[model samples]
Target: MAVSLDMLSLLPDPLLIIIISLLPFKEAIRTSVFSKSWCNNKLFKLTTNIEFNELFFVKSYQPSIKHLQRKAFLDFITFWIDNNKESIIEKFSLKLSMPNNVSELTEKCIAFATHKGGVKHLELDFSDPKWVEYNNVAPYHKFHEPMFALPKHVYDELKGIQILKLYSCRFVEKDLLNFHALKEVSFGWMEVSIFLINSLISNCKMLESLSLKRCWNFSEFYLRDRNQKLKKLVVDNCSFQYELFRVVAPNLKFFKYSGMMSYFDIKGCPQVEVADLDFSTEFGFGGKGYRLYNFMEDFYSLKVLTVCSYFLQVIPHGSDMLRMERNFNIRHLTIKTQLNKSDYRGIVFMLRSCPMLQCLTIQLGCARIWPNYAQPFASAPKNFWTENVRIYECLKSSLEVLEVKGFQGFDKSEIRMLAYFIQSGKVLKKMTINMEKDIILSCNRNLDLNPRKFAEFLLKVPRASTDLEITIC
Candidate 1:
């Protein structure tokens, strides 16, 4: 072991730095003790990415320990920044486990890394458990002081930053006229206002991707981009109400919205090709019933789409094909929803819109049904297979691959559904089925649960396409 350790010291300095930089901060510092030759070497000076979290700096997970080592932790961080002041850091991440009385120290450390080392990717997670417990507490309260604040001057000074991620922190507005280097921004578990969000979008001219997760206190969100710089946008679990959320990005390409059943007016995004919408319709679905159809209309150029039953329930049923204003040029479609008898219509509804569909994926899970019992349980039209073959031309000629996950081979309905696809898919090349539970590897262990027997039984079924490869796993 000692000889092996000595051999590591003889390696080139760049390789040693790469190995050290991949480790946590404390582990990286311990590399100096490997051999006498590595002592006080350029490991600290050459390292670029630095990450500090509770696992490295904190002695214990108890919240009480936060106060005990608060000062020493701050002092150590200040010393580290000064030691690596000359290094060109590409990424710096800091995550505090608990709330501390001295929050300014963290702010200063973050500012120093961004302003001095020219860090391009900065992630700060200062979330405290107490914030969620006392969410009713006003932002001006003393407890809120522990939340890291990204002041306007910090953004102004760090003009070269391209990716900025913040969790449970505050974004303050400033005269950010020169802040144009940002290409991506993400916010999670934080409080943000409409003005700050607008400032971020308007000031960052080069931003291409933006994500908001579990952010609150904003009811309405409006975005209009004429320059087409922002291409990807994600709004996950945000507080949005009926008809209050609107976006107009002419050149935007990718979009995903997951939240309550809200009205979305996303128009002019002609370049959009991929979309994922997972919103709940438990609320009143009257005013927002037509929103999904309208939203789909704006994305006529979409090639990929993912949706839940909430989107399917809004479309009228009983037609061989869904009544759509225009057909979609979708090539790949993914459906994540509970598979009951009536839910099959939703799958066909998607197939009706995407005439150019090729790859299809269906995941069985829980589906959110309407709250009122008045809504009829719409099943597929009589002889749904004949209608599928008659209406959806893709199933006959274009669809080549079909993948069904969480498949229970014993279920009669699931087996029948699979058989219909096999009989109808004329141009199908590959069919993959993933079982719900692991089958016994040894036949002696459990004969009935053997996967080989199951696959053999499925192979006996008739297939429309002669050149098909069926894989069971």
Candidate 2:
């Protein structure tokens, strides 16, 4: 029952189309007039949600779609609300690109959804830049304000929204408290101002989950209150001021992040269950001050941990890896890095740290480079870790399920690393050598290490009782 110009030509007559589209139960009456053979209530009912995806494009000569005139936009919106006044929309969405300056059309859509109380899920996608480029949308100024940057009276009409998602749309402090029942909020690639941050804390009282990904400018966030019923919080890939992990959510069940020079200062929430902290360490950060050590204090109840492997050359200055001995309650640990250099501190950290550490999947690299000052790792001072990584022979004590992705040759460093795992992980169940094809081709073409020989050397490593699995891709 799509309303289209061709719909009239497809049917027998104009009067039939008018009866089919404009009247009450118009479809039923139209089908009755169409010899009764055209009756299909199930199809029409099912198609009710099938919004006409009326996509029109002008390729050769881009049609300057007459700018959505203010009057027409308002009238069309008013008509929709007037018609569906009794119907409560479950999912309300609008993707019309109103001329950049005239945000009134956009405002009307928001106002309509606001007055309509049944909107449970709402999505307002600002059109993609390329689409605008193709369409020749003139005077297209970027949106750097909240989706509904209207006056208070405008927002007064909006209420009862649950899940609100805004992508690439700026949000101001005032936009925070607009939705009283807002549960889940997602802001992608948008700037979050300090004022807006505080507003969210005070306003979004029932907010259960919040994710700010790639949205930048504000860094080092401090929650206004620690106990805001929020269960999950995720902040990833954003460039913000370096702040220690300072979130006080006693009810927070999950906190995940992927960033630089960061640390977590959890408020001891027993509810936090899983943390995907791909946090960088000193080694991961080219031997900087401390690789987000302040974060070691988090995860009192963390059950899952995924750590990025340190770059193999940068040596940590202090007792870098030792401090991590007791912090993690990880039952599953995935370490991503290689023994590109004789990074003993890193080796020991991955091999030994997790006392309760069970499932271990090591995405290691074969490219090895030892520090010029590096003698046997143990020769370094007690404060100087990587002193003797042979101690990794200790990992065999409890580690099981070892998956080494990006495996290359059995270089001396890798042999040493592998030997440690074979000896230490006595309880080891399965050891896998996941090698990439590029590694073999690179060795053959660049490093000149015979792939077959290197692989054979790795296979011969002594694993007392552990079953080994080698997979090359």
Candidate 3:
């Protein structure tokens, strides 16, 4: 049987280029051998995006041949760029290792992408590929500094770029200038000074989203721009030199922070609609709980709130609960926590604070507990859900949906918590219990009970909402 080789030839050049672009870099280049029309300059010159990854070339090779592979990779990219010099690339991504002498090559690549191609999205990841093989715990600090430093003149060419992501590359802060077309920027595993960060934010007037992850060398981060156009900001696992962190973006909408708890002074961001707080450290200080409580008051306009188990455990309870005078405008609240004795007071505090909450989601067994000061998982009292808890306004009126994710069938505390919500949530419309498959396997091995029967038993529980529907999956 003869197959039709002319089928690909019937498609338009733009469509063929797109189809080839979706393939792996090696496979994309290999398509040129199929026909002369699909050669290097003919079809690929119209391609708007290109990604060159060094790991892709060296993944199957031994460590000794990696240098030769790197050379070949460089030559191939150089040849490709020589052929497609006139093409306007929309996105250019290069992930490779940078030794001491590779700055010139890096600069040339950046120049090709920015000055020649007018690339809008550029990502240059110079992080060591071995970092991945070592479970992302490679000793990056042992290298003392980032191997590659972005040249000062490169900032001028980056003005047209809309999205830029740099990993393990140093920046010359003094050379930074206005990026008029830049909208989103991300920095990972790099040393960012406070002045440099502030300067970037000030200069990138059109920047809408900013993310910093595992960044070091900056202590006091202050985003005090009143007319800032930033809409979303994320700071994840960044090591700070000091404890002070503040933000004053007036037009900011979404803010997510995940790291050690610090002295946070988030204010002036009245337009914030969503906030995620995931602290890895345990609350050990005297007034940290009070500080967190006061910190939450700054996000008055927040509609969606996500908190971790540590956040719940740190909330001040007992007499301190009386100090919570502000009711959050959060319509949806997601708690990524395990149902344990330590979380009871914090859960109650959150429920009381969000009176207008319309949706409540409890994600179980996903909380990151600090290794040094992990809290014990003790069972709650028998009357804990009934007599100990007060009827919150959200459950009585505003709350309509309840979702329990990562549900482990054997936890009595979790079972009681679900029952409490079913019986108290008067306006509730739906309750979804998403079970963990591993939990089901364990239950089948240890107990004689069927999961369906257990689900049916839960359905038989007395519910306050007459129109409520329960779904178990």
On TM-score, the stronger of 1 and 3 is 3
**Model 1 pairs in collision:** none
| Tens digits of lDDT, candidate 1, 1-473 | 34344787788888877877777666776777776666857564566777766445556557688656655666777777777666667778887744345557676667666667377888888876444432212111222332666655676567788888888777654644355788988887876666676667788888888888767667688877755788999987665433478787877899998776556677667788899987553453443445566666677888998887666666543232365657788899988755554456566777776777899987655434554422235445344444435536788778999988766544456666777888778888999987644332211122234578767767887888998899887
Model 2, residue 193: displacement in angstroms? 2.3
Tens digits of per-residue lDDT for model 3 on 136-233?
Answer: 12212332367687766668766677898888887766655466677888988777776776677778778889898767877677776644788999
Question: Candidate 1 at 220: error in angstroms?
Answer: 2.6
TM-score of each: 0.76, 0.60, 0.78
**Candidate ranking (lDDT, best to worst):** 3, 1, 2
Residue 36 of model 3 has an lDDT of 67
> lDDT tens string, model 2, 1-473?
97435343355543453444333333333355344323432222211111111122212233444233434544555565555544434555554433245476566556555564556666565534333221111212233433333335434544676777665554444655778787887775457764575567568787888887656666576654444688888876555576554677778887787665445567555568777754342223334324444344445466666655432223233346443535467677765665443455554554455567677776654333422334224433222322333444335455666776666654555555665666556677677766665755654634435767766876777765545454433
Error of 2 at 53 (Å): 12
What range of 10 consecutive residues in model 1 has the weakest lDDT sum? 134-143
In candidate 2, which residue ranges exceed 4 Å CA deviation? Answer: 1-117, 124-158, 217-220, 241-245, 262-264, 267-271, 278-291, 310-316, 319-327, 342-344, 364-394, 406-424, 432-461, 466-473
- Assess each prediction's global lDDT (C-alpha) against the native: 0.68, 0.53, 0.75
| Per-model root-mean-square deviation over C-alphas | 6.7, 11.5, 5.6
